[model samples]
Target: MRCKSLDFIFDYFQQIPTMELEEITFSGWTAIEEKNLHAGEKPKDEKVYTMYHGTFLKYVQHIITSGFQRSRDGMLGSGVYVSRNIDKAKCYPLNADKKEAVVLKLKVRVGKVKKIDIDNHPLQKSWHQNGYDSCWVPPNCGFTAIKSGREEDCVWDPARIVVVDVACCLDDKTRWDLRKQIRGMNNHGAKDGCSQCHQNTSNTGSHPIQSCWTCTKQICPFQKKHVCNK
Candidate 1:
């Protein structure tokens, strides 16, 4: 597909008054049985379920990876979903409750090619390295940047991210309850204590052990110290 500038894409989405839910096949892991499946195991099949739960809009589906066969290429067209049922997650604390299977809505966009000024290309070096060929910008978490091009030839642009509310699924009371629960969790904080280190102490010295940002768990200080010293 021809690459459009972020401003152009944003303008295109802005013209879309109503966003429609187009059911797309998604293949990925689920919280059904085995928490962690082997590489050869087939991924679970799921579809996008879009709905508006009062104030919050939800788009639940199995996680899906970008079609890129290689990992070195970085994440492109990957869809990420935040699970509501944290207990079922393999990485989450085992003692947590496993009740509802909910996930947060995600927004994704495909990368496209955009022509750049030959003299003032952003990715001029990359372009030269790739036999002075046309550059491609891979999609990231938010925006897309040209890949395999001279730095001066390519540029990153912010596109208009379209977030749609298909329809209302949860009632007012239920939505309010969920909102309250999420707020409470955010205010209180998540579970802590690193599984690897099991150290619950705070940073003592100048070079203290770093904690996992997600779970607020402290890593092994001794291990970090050894690595740094080496």
Candidate 2:
């Protein structure tokens, strides 16, 4: 059978008895910050920013490529995109240069994830949103910690986590289609106010295929009255 979107793949995997998948749900925030640069003799503030739609695609690619890792000091961990509605997404530095910044909801699944504690020996206290805790997860591992009495308990919920593994889940065609859809969305030229129908043209200024119309229809349910230009 053919799968059209990542959501379909996620649903299909959820029902497999032998696969033994565990779902992890969370939200992640990223921002397109404007930096003042001092270049050459003439130093001027350069506006460096990315489109919200493009950033969203990159965020998804990061999750697919890097997998998820445990957060440390409330920073530097991979996350996935989970929300179907772009409007409800979260973004950091709320006051970004462009209003197009966004936050993404992520739903991820892994066969297993190992949780460990680093509060031994001299007893170092680790800080997290929950509180002072020493729980840490290894690279390529997913974990969540809850305080229990005097100590924090940690365990390996699963053996490992893998994304887009052809031997296990997702065929080549489906993966290709997924990547193409993301790239097409990133390259689409309708960055201004939303239009009823978006004309997706190629870099060479030619209509390759009516791919954007189909993409907008299938992927952009959040868009208001947006259609693909045939």
Candidate 3:
């Protein structure tokens, strides 16, 4: 399918079975106060300037990538636009300015970055906070962390699309149309809100129901009602 936005990619990851996925982790720079006092450290032990170091970058990669490509399409090197793989989503610490060879080497040895810390790595922090994951590294999605025995293939090839997301504009559009339809039925007596047509989320809010309008076999509550209302 043609990917018009990034949500298509995130929805794909959300479909992934969590049992097959891992929670996100990362590594980068951090700031720490200096503490090199000759005889007396102020405050009984004054702390000095800080520096960024990495120590856990490899872990947070997947979770962060999924988040970045969640809502909208974003930029990468060469102004390339594409979808992300939720299962293998993660970010790397290379700038567009870095040499491709160096970036490739760094990505392959992601685990070696364990010593790096977030405070030192502002970009990494940006990735984490913004959910930047699922970026393409050279041949595929960034290489997977290598453990001894479980040879799971982490690298993703764009050429081999194993799955795709279906087009479902029905959800949002239905709510809008339903409002019109219900309004026509009410002729101004019935109040129009999702809560009235649907129930409270139980958590205490309402979401519009999903369904197709004309071109379908009976699919969802909205569709069934369309037929019954007729």
Report the C-alpha lDDT of model 3 over 1-230, residue by residue, as the tens digit. Answer: 66657887888899988785675433222344344322111111122211111112332232111211132322221111221221111222323221111110111101111111212334322332333322222222232331111111111111111111111112455434434543343332212224223321223234555433444333323111333222
| Model 1: per-residue Cα lDDT over 78-165, one tens digit each | 1221111122122222232322222222221213323333343464334324332222222221222423221211212111111222
Worst 10 residues of 1 by lDDT: 62-71
Clashing pairs in 2: 82-105, 82-106, 90-103, 112-158, 112-159, 113-158
Q: What is the C-alpha RMSD of each candidate to the true structure, in Å?
A: 25.0, 23.1, 27.4
Give the alpha carbon lDDT tens digit for every residue of 54-100 in model 2: 12333445533333343232221222212112232233323443333
- State which candidate has the highest lDDT: 2
Candidate with better lDDT, 2 vs 3: 2
Judged by lDDT against the true structure, how good is candidate 2? 0.29
